[model samples]
Target: MEEYGYLWQLALILMSTKFLGLLTKRYKMPQVVGALLAGLLLGPAVLGNLLSGVVIGGHHLENLALHQTDFIEHLSEIGVIVLMFCAGLETDINELKKCGKASFIIAVLGVIAPLIGGGAFTYWFLEEGWIEASPDSSLFIQAVFVGVVLTATSVSITVETLQEMGKLKTASGNAILGAAIIDDILGIIVLTIVTSLGGGKATAGDSAPLWLVLLKIALFFVFVAIFGYIVYKFFKWWRQRDGKGMHRHAIMAFVICLLMSFAAEYFFGVADITGAFFAGVIISMTQEDQFIASKFDVIGYMFLSPIFFASIGLKVDGDAVMSMGWTVAVFAVLLTVIAVVTKIIGCGLGAKVCGYKNYQCIRIGVGMISRGEVALIVANKGIEAGLMSSAVVAPVIIVVIVTTIVTPIVLKPVFMSGNKTASDVPTTSKLVENYEQREKIGKTNR
Candidate 1:
């Protein structure tokens, strides 16, 4: 029964997502937020308690168990891959090159600010005075892990907001996207170094030295730099041969993404999501990037993405959150506030350093504020290792949820409420003209 229960889970996920998604869209929210709520609605946090055995369509949700469904969890994992893949696909390499110095500066500062600010706040939660049972070193690792978690920017929510605001192509938006991607890569590197040094109980820190870890990281990048180039050249050749049809290109796109994803985890000990993201970046450097992005969008946004967003809500342990006590709760709220502030300041400062107008810097910072899958995944790794307590998990999840929910809701208004718009984003006529020129250029290249 469990083996076949994913069918019911799929039905409910899609139904709840579209229904709730429509509601969010109506309220001018990204569909991603609604999809998350849909997951919550049908997950153990909500539905499991309310309608555990209630039968509908001759299927008992009792048999589906979306919150802990192993099958659905795997599907949701793929959803992350798809999300990262699409991010890579849509990333404008030319824009990144044009904005290279600024983007790199922003990404570095964005990461540092979170690590410093979030780490300090997280240290408050880690103090032996607060939780004496955990070791001091263990607590330090957890604190570092928390800061590492905060460094992650899911960007999918921000992507939706920017797309809606017609800011996806704006200078600030490109900076945000580039910085977000850079931070993911940097965050992964930080996690690798920290975890290898025994930040989590599941890892053997004493067994591996710092030099060896750094060496492996260096080797990983050398491998990426080399192989990534080969893959890039091959895809460019494939693009030239793609006039016959795009079906094969689509298959190759997914395959390449999966291959890179597997290599990231299997070989480099990095998150496969990072590999998947690079795979998309590889594609984005091509003539067919937009086409590939749209193709994946249909399959990803329509199908896989809903499962991923919904799965997040399914993990909500309301009981755990409740039992965390007021102290932990206060800390959680503090952590969330810090997460917002650090992102705005850190990333904003980075943009300012690049000579962006003060408002544009603010926009970049606000855009980078959200934390999603990466944060949760980091926390889960810590909890699995016993380095992080279950008591802490609740607060961490709460923080992720609050930040994710708030990023989209506040992004546009922050941008729109500011003045000097006509000179900022492209006017409608210019936008149309630019689109036509790109289309013509795209055709000429083809």
Candidate 2:
């Protein structure tokens, strides 16, 4: 059956994304671009619309292509979680620590710039009659929420690009990763404050106090520390006892990732991806990290990641977006420009202030530009709160797609043009050298 139609839809998504991914790879761009394009082409935006209104054997063919949108969306969520988990596994903790201060500065500026830029634009757009707000909703809260949406940085795309380029271990790459994690935390704080002030517009009930929000975030980290240590020891012991490489260890790692992900959202109101990432970080402290990462990568790359990337493209509401007319189109274009430029200027200034090379600064800025599920989540909150018009989502979707697409395109060149200097190269190389030396010392002792 019809009940099993998702099978064929899955097939289409994988094949299309992979083929397009290969096409993009030829142009020296990240395969993520191809995957995104494939989604847009196959979803209601392009090909899906073409199939509209056709009936065969009393069954609509349109439903066949989009078989189980909810199911596919869930799979995509798992995809990003797994991707971030893998990033955590591969991350160099020492390098991440070294970049801590710089990452904080970068994240702070990254959030502030977008918050101001997006909020200003929304207020101006409202003044110009480009968008509308409910009479009950405060224009100030609406503007701030839009800015909060812009502050999100979906670094999954950047992680893939860095991994493809073999720069995931580079100092600049470490800075990007560290800054993104901080960015997520800071973003949540800002969202909590704004949504609280929005007076339950963003949620079903009264929002928690700012102090409670801070407490929850702090507790999440404390939970990570205590639980991470326990899991680290358990895995270490598991590896020592199972001298014959058992596959179950990887399964256990997956369980921990899922648990952390659940806890993050359920208990802390933090992003699940944050939980999955730290789970990987905890496991990375174990001897089986490489093995588990390899296993998870197979699950992520072969199945989940393509769907995740494509699901983003699948979100484009072609008719709604296209019907918005010239004014909304202009707003979309200008908003996209604002989204791109504010991130670069903001994060770039932060990096520059922290003594990063100009090219490295640009790289960090570009890496933080993409906004994904997070932005959509914020926009949905605004809609629920009556702070934003449902029609505004079309423009937000365009911003997400454009920013996501451009990050890799622009990052590739910035990364390529930079000659490695002492500032950019030292921490990365030193970390590698130290890791190797430690390994050699362990072998000698054994």
Candidate 3:
């Protein structure tokens, strides 16, 4: 029999996540924190390594071998996509429209600040003998690539954190989500530009001309518009004919989510989460959205979500940290600090310019701090293109782990410290009135 390793791994993950999730909840921290800690504890960084060495009578210990596997990775991917889809279902389109301009500004500044900050820091660090570059590699290009890495914002953690606090519908929450989506787009464009500058190498999608890359992105929107309309009409028709709460509707929702996700990465070079999010937004306009969300929520919560959160912690290679020596360890620590502070300052300045209150600005900045896997992906691309060394991967991993852990811890308190204003977020009834007012204004302008 093929060893049933995955079964035990899944069991350990779910049990530990549940126990630690409740443990963190009792301390008024987001339960996601506990789930993260659980992964760290069970992963190679901590317990996995400790237990791997022990043996009872001749059989080697195999229980805590929660090293991340392909199976768990795929499940976690579904969990995050599902999480973002649920977020889209809850989003108010009208409200999102009101913040659209602000979102773009925040994203632009957010990306620029980190790009500059990381690049400047890396350049200085190189000058100070912190980084050892590969032969004949341009330090300036390497610095730029590091900055590109910093420009990424992984909002899955932020989404979970905001949902737990019931702030997902708030102004700051919407801004964070909106900016993050735009940030991903901007980061991709910047990554493509930086990668293309490397010596005749195709890094990520840099093999294509910039204009072609952009055109594909534009076509992706067209794809969404056509497919989104079809989805909207089909869901509405089905709901009218069969009423609601059907299991098939929930199943169809998953199909649509996966289809969009595949098309995004495979065809358009966009993040799969972006496609999943738009799928949810399109569905949200249909009558079955809430029911679908409820059904999907249970699936995500019970299985995929825990695996997703835990898988992040499982990426930590404690041996890499220890082997890289104190000098590299110090670099990782400083880089982590730079990663956190740059995002806050850059995004916060954008919020302030958009006329948000200071508290809201702070919350928005904190919300965007989590780099997650986005940074790692970018760094990997840089390495493949020969613009970056393999050595940087360790520090980048540390940055991802730190930022992922810190975003939620800092975000919850920032949100709790401030009360939302009506101007910032319209009430449900006011949403209808504002929608009508905007309609009238559109007619007048036309």
Candidate 4:
């Protein structure tokens, strides 16, 4: 009876997620926005307490509606790994190379600016008279984690927006994609360091020494190289066997993903999602990359990922956030604004340094501003690691929601304006054709 409770939970989440997904799509927003809201609604924040009396299981013995969070968190964690793995598989390694040194430069500055912005804010909150000091967590480490959260970029939302504007292949667009991939790798490195070095003052002694941590990091990469080579060969062998559609082939890939994830956390002190991501990257050069990506994409987004997004919103505590007071609220607002503005300045500045025009710089900045799954994943890690306070969770959620919603609202008109951007200026002939094309496309479709 208890085992069957999970089935009921799954059924409710999937149905609610789909219904909200359609609603959001109808309103010209990403389906995820609604899925997250649905989760929040279903969880303690909204509908959880309201529906506590509802008996969901067939035997009516378990209270599925009232509190299914611990179990849901496990599902969401799987979703995170699957999501990152898909991201790795979908990555265009050649595009990353084509961006060349620009990707490195952009990623560096992109990471730096946010680290400064978010870190400075946290430092002020702790050091200055703004927020009361708690002995439980180290202010310094928590500040660093704040900066770490800002390092993430959710390029999927930007990809869709750029595609709609017919600019996905343009210079700025490609730069965004390439830089984002590099940014993820860079972010994982930063995360691994911060997570390993210790979480808070209360737990600093629990961290490995610098040398040991470095050695583990080095050993992890070595493991990745060797394991990646072996997996690469396995992919080749599987190809020769014509196992493209074979369930066993896909199952093996997943097994490899799970093993990589386990090894990263248990053996290397690296985040499990980072392992899953790199594993996907290792196999991405394979002929089966597309096949693996598509299958995992379906399984992840269609089944696992919505749960992750929803769980983020569901776990948010308005009371905990409010308890942090007006200063923290101001910080959240500032964090959101900084999250939006700095990426544009940092990445756009990098683009400008790369000889892109002002409009292209702006586009690049806009493209990098949206923080999606990765940021949420980092926030979850920080909270779990006890590096971030409960107060920061609300801010992190707000960062995800605000940055996601803000990017499209700001991007649509920037690309449509009279000013000619470097990558998107239409010639007179093309303008005439586009005008005619606009007549055929519906407003909702646009």
lDDT digits (tens) for residues 42-126 of candidate 4? 7665665555456655434224342446788898889888888876775556546665787678888898889888888878887
lDDT of 2 by residue, 1-446 (tens): 85776788898999999999899778645566677778778887777788889999998777655532777867877787787787577665665575568888999999999999999998887777665455546677777778888998888678678767877667688778788867765776676556545653434355677788778878988999999989988877876877775588888999999999889777886656668878888988888776677677677767887887777667666666566568778888898999999999999999999988888899889888988656755665555456676557667877887887788888888888888775444344454454445435433432
Across 104-167, the per-residue lDDT of candidate 3 in tens digits comes to: 8999999999899889888787667665653435688888889999998988778777766767
lDDT of each: 0.72, 0.76, 0.75, 0.75
TM-score of each: 0.78, 0.74, 0.71, 0.85
Candidate rank order under TM-score = 4, 1, 2, 3
Q: What is the overall TM-score of model 3 with all chains considered together?
A: 0.71
Q: Is candidate 1 or candidate 4 better by lDDT?
A: 4
Ranking by lDDT: 2, 4, 3, 1
Candidate scoring better on TM-score of 1 and 3: 1
Model 4 spans > 4 angstroms off? 1-5, 48-68, 127-137, 199-205, 241-245, 417-446
Highest TM-score among the candidates is held by which one? Answer: 4
- Per-residue lDDT over 342-396 for candidate 1, one digit per residue giving the tens place of the 0 to 100 score: 9899999988888888888888999998887667666655554455665565566
